[model samples]
Target: MPPIRTFTAALGLAAMTATLLVSAAEAAPRNRYVQVQGADGRGYVASRNAHRTSSSFTANRSIQTNGGYGLNRNRSAAYGEGSYSGSSQTVFNSGRSINRSASVHDNGDGTASYQRTVTGSEGRSRSVSGSVPYTPPQ
Candidate 1:
């Protein structure tokens, strides 16, 4: 009877210890980020904060290449319930640069209208607006 009681007490203590350790390990959420290998002679890396289902999302990414005379690129984007927006910039080793920004909004009828602005190293900027129908992939 004494041996049986001792075994039961040890088992209960072990279970409680395991539960405490597991809970302590679950800490807070960490921000999300990703890095991808080379694509078309360039590599990309990006990161964003974790968002709940009801919250909007924003992310930033950059791409660059190695060796001499490579190019660098940066971009950021955001998404909300009925709209999305983004911007990007590219810089070349030769001291040339180009920047672009774009936004899109839903039209409530399975289509969206978008506007885009672009500026080049020559300091010229232009904007374009158009609409496109949306069809989900099969």
Candidate 2:
């Protein structure tokens, strides 16, 4: 009877430790910014921010130069309940840009469907979509 009680206590302690470990792994949001300039008045500035969780994440970045050139980009995604969706876009000061998006959903029959699209800087767009068998990671 003593051995049985000891085993049970050890199991309970292990469960609690596992829960705390999982909680500690969740990270907080982060942000960064930087700028540089020279005596010649030529310089650039940049910034980035990001956040993440057990199921979702989002991020963006931007850069600007003193020569009238600039760039911006953004992306985000989330997954849960057998589905996922994400999109991204990038643009430049010269009117050139690219955009993309994708989505996937489980069919509940051991397969999943997906769709994706991409648009280039010249405004020409292309898309490809298909389905495949899905196996969730253990």
Cα lDDT of model 2 overall?
0.70
Residues 1-138, candidate 2: write the lDDT tens digits. 254433433332333223223342565887999999977899999999987665676889999998889999998876666666777899998989999986666677876666667899888998766656555433
Q: When superposed on Cα atoms, how far off is each prediction in RMSD?
A: 22.0, 14.2
lDDT of each: 0.54, 0.70
Candidate 1's residue-wise lDDT over 1-138, tens digit each? 255433433333333223223332343333655666675655555554422122222333333344344456666555555566667787877889999887666666875666678899999998766656543222
Report the error of model 1 at residue 16, Å: 48
Candidate 1 off by > 4 Å: 1-67, 109-111, 133-138
- Candidate 2 residue 17 Cα shift, in angstroms, is 24
Candidate number achieving the greatest TM-score relative to the actual structure:
2
